[model samples]
Target chain A: MTQRWKLTIEYDGRPFVGWQRQDNGLSVQGCLEEAVRRFSGEAATVHAAGRTDAGVHALAMVASLDLEKQCRPDTVRDALNHHLRPHPVSVLSAEPMAEDFHARFSCRGRSYLYRIVNRRAPLALEAGRAWQVSVPLDAEAMQEAAQRLVGRHDFTSFRASLCQAKDPVKTLDRLDVERVGEEIRVTTAARSFLHHQVRNMVGTLKLVGEGKWAADAVTAALEARDRAKAGPTAPADGLYFTGAWY
Target chain B: MTQRWKLTIEYDGRPFVGWQRQDNGLSVQGCLEEAVRRFSGEAATVHAAGRTDAGVHALAMVASLDLEKQCRPDTVRDALNHHLRPHPVSVLSAEPMAEDFHARFSCRGRSYLYRIVNRRAPLALEAGRAWQVSVPLDAEAMQEAAQRLVGRHDFTSFRASLCQAKDPVKTLDRLDVERVGEEIRVTTAARSFLHHQVRNMVGTLKLVGEGKWAADAVTAALEARDRAKAGPTAPADGLYFTGAWY
Candidate 1:
């Protein structure tokens, strides 16, 4: 007999290739599945709510798996954690779920947080965790300009060239930019996001923050609906998968 | 004639042995001094306001040095940062100071922060940055009990056996513990502290937070004037040098 388990996980993305298994290097998924196999002696497959690119971190990424061993939810969590000691991934929680529940398909919403250290000094403690921009950024201007992107639109200008989405339209529920001390944080949420959508949007907003672009340019780019019309895509280091709403 | 310089530094203390120059391995002080030498070809000595033990971090530690090379403050800051690229230390700022000014003797107050991750799950992102306590801690009770240690007293029970302070009496200006999300942060300020004083106090407070000891027990430990009567010393990973007040 097999049991379905839903899990919430936290990870530091620096050590793995990405959330999915890859041929070239170690992946977060591979580490988790191996831990499960070591703990339960079963070759159960694990699935994630969403896939992330290389060097992108997740705070509360939702995942699901199956097990033939009869064990409590807390026991499953602790045992997996014990086996996963060498990796930078933690099973924060585990719960029994319905047989039909799916981690990727059952999710209703997702949110991301982008961090920028707007200072001239190079980062020491936050290296590999946040992006460092030497120039001073006008956060208030970035906040005002980000509002233009907070609605349903044809986001062709923001989607990656390799995006496999059938449509470029997405309903962006929230796009907020705020300054906390020496850091500028941009947070966004939606039911779903196109490939490289959040990074492209943030890279575009950074131009407005640097006084290189204006609100009019953003509106024009959205209207153009051309991939080449928008700014460059930001680095993967600053983007974090913050949460998922089900 | 050599000129005096005051500097504010930030560092990740994981790689080095400690803040001072050690014979066994690399140190933060040695890195700064070598960076200064490489940048200006001057063999200047870098001095810190407070010496931290192995694996302790700092946000804004104050230091001073003497340089015969003439340069702008910003130039000094950027140039030193450039030379210190490979190390996990950064010079936040550099300022020309009066000849009589000294980082250690002129400091009026010092503040430290101790972080505890109060969760059943192990840490992933905060490894080596915080102390993870698997048992549930009573934050409100801990906060109420922390007030008992805020005043002038002989902290002999909290002093390390290797402490070299001439007197055990010191004025503790502030000691507060608050919970931020899943973390419990304990902040303390004093004119000066005996070796391992902050860690010992935090260790005793952990007993209070765990319900193993009470406020009366804390008072009795203080009045005993013996290190054996107090709780065990906390790990060095949780403590951080927050600031130095002039």
Candidate 2:
């Protein structure tokens, strides 16, 4: 009997082309699928909750796959981790799931975190993990601006032009901006997001943080309903897919 | 005419042989010295508060150097950082210092942080940055054991045999262990440390953290006055040269 399993995973996204399997280079999904094939002797495809862009990390991404081999939860987790080694991807836990459960379609919510190192010096330890913004940022101003985007709204101005989502409306649950020492962190949650919504919102808020735009400017950008009205998209290095709620 | 400058630096030590210059691979000191040569046309050596081993990292390492070129503090800091590009090193700040000030000899305190990822999964985001101990760790036991190493004592057991310090007896100002989420953090401060002192102590504490030894075992190991009586030296990956006080 085939068993469906849900896997919680973490990875450093620098090496992968992105979460989706592409012909150009390595992807996190491709790596996990290879590990699964090696362990189960089946060419099963693993599905993730989100298709993160290139250089986007994941703290606890959930994925689902079917396996023909019968194994305990611990054995599945350890075996996948062992085979995935040398690559910076880890399966944190594996659990049996009902056949109806799905990693993407059945997901209820998603959360993300973005880190900005606000300093004049170049980063050494956190170079690839965080975005280094040499300009001093007023995190309080960013926090004030972030509140403007915190409810049900059409986010076309913040969404990527290439986004395939049929609808532009998404309910944002949370959008928090805070400063911890030299790093400014932005965290957000939503039932779903149009592609690049988080990064675009962060980039727009950054202008407010730098005092180049007033806090109310974000409202104007959102009301414009045009992608060009919003600020530039932030780099993918700073974005992380934190978790998903079923 | 020479200007004495005190520089605060941050480095990812994985690419370096160590903090000191050596004939082997690249060294952090050698890179700084070369940066100084490129920036100021001087071959002056840079001295650091601690000589971190390979694979170690630094958050705010203090250093001292003499520059014959007269420049503003910001210029020196910025220029040195510009030249140290492509290497995982950065000059965080440069300040004018009195000739009496020295990074090594005049330092009054040194602090270190050791990170342990106490989880079954192999680390992905923190792979090279933290030590992964698959066995569940008892952080409370580790904390109590760590207290035994605090205070003035002959720490020969924790000291590396090749340490050149004349006296093993030194007062440890702090040796605090605490659990932060999945990480077991060991923070310690002292006027100075014997070579590999922090790593050795952390290794010993791991035994207690694993329930393999009682907390009182630390006392016996300290009293033994022999390095062999202590646990094996922990890997340099988890150790960070946090800061130094003048």
Candidate 3:
């Protein structure tokens, strides 16, 4: 008999070539699948709630897999963590889930956090973990501009060119910008996102933070429905898949 | 004409051998001196507020150096940071200082922060930045025990075997243990500390947190006045030289 397991994972993402298994380099999915193979002796396919891009971290990414052999939830988590040694990845928790449950399909909402170090000096402790923006940014202005992106609308201005989503429309549940000490954080939530949507929105808001674009400009860009009208996509270093709510 | 300058620095500390200049490997002082030489064309000797051990990080370590060239404070900081490229050490700020100002000798108080991630799974993003303890620790109990070591006392038991201090008696201004989510933070301040004294005290407190040793046991260890009486010294990964006050 086979049992389905739900796994919560955390990864640095600096060394991974994204969440999907790729021929070029390492992937978080590949690591988890290999760990499952080693521990359960079954060549399993691991699926994640979000397919994070290269250099994008995850705090509590939801994933699911099936194992032929019977094992305790703790055993599955511990065994996978042990096998993923020195890879900057950890299986935080594991639980037996219903066969009908799916990590991606069953997920109701997903949240992400993007970190920006607003300082003149370069980063030392957070070298690869955050995007260091040398210019000082006004978080309040960014917050106001971000509000223009919320609600159901066509996100063609924010979506990547290669986005595979069937529709360009997405309902953004929340988009907030706040400052914590020397860092500016952008938090967002939605049922699903177009490729590079979060990063592109953050990039566009940064212009407002720097006093280059106003809140009305963001609304204009959204209405224009052209990717070229919006700001550039922010780097992947600062993006984090925070959680997925069922 | 020589001008004395004060520098506030931040470093990751994983790549270097410590703050002092050494022959074996790279040091924070050596990097600063080299950067000074490259920018000012002067063989400057950089001094630090604390000579941290290997693998110990710093958030705002105060240092001083004398340069013969005339340069603005901002220029000194920017040039040194530019020349110190690729190294984890960074000069956060620079200011002109009086000749009497000394990085180590003139410091009135020093503060350090030790981070411990109390979680079952291993660290992912903060692998080398924090200590990962699998067992759950009682932070309140640890805080209560820490008060026993406060005030002026002979911390002989907590002193390192290689400590160079002339006397073991030192006044501990503060020792606090607090829990934030899954992380335990130990913050301490003192006029001066014996080598490895903070780490030793934290290690002994861990025993009390784990229920292996009682609060009185920590007092007994201090009263023993022997190095072997205290717990083992904690690793250098979790320690950070936070700041120095003049």
lDDT of 1 by residue, B68-115 (tens): 999999999999999998898988899999988888998999999999
lDDT of 1 at B51: 90
Model no. 1, DockQ: 0.81
Evaluate all candidate structures by whole-model CA lDDT and list the values in order.
Answer: 0.92, 0.95, 0.94
Model 2 DockQ class: high
lDDT of 2 by residue, B1-246 (tens): 898999999999889999999999899999999999999899998999999999999999999999999999999999999999989999999999998889999999999999999999999999778899988889999998888989999999999989999999989989988999999999999999998999999999999999988988899999999999999898898999999998
TM-score, predicted candidate 1 vs. hidden true structure: 0.98
What's the C-alpha lDDT at position A194 in model 1? 96
The top-ranked prediction according to lDDT is 2
Write the residue-wise lDDT of candidate 3 on A124-156 in tens digits: 888888998988899999998899999999999
Residue A165, model 2, lDDT = 97
Per-candidate iRMSD? 0.8, 0.6, 0.7
**Segments of candidate 2 deviating more than 4 angstroms:** none
Each candidate's number of clashing pairs is 0, 0, 0
**Scored by Cα lDDT, where does model 1 land?**
0.92
Model 1 misplaced regions, further than 4 Å:
none
Lowest summed lDDT across 10 adjacent residues in model 2 chain A is found at A126-135
Clashing pairs in 1: none
Clashing pairs in 3: none
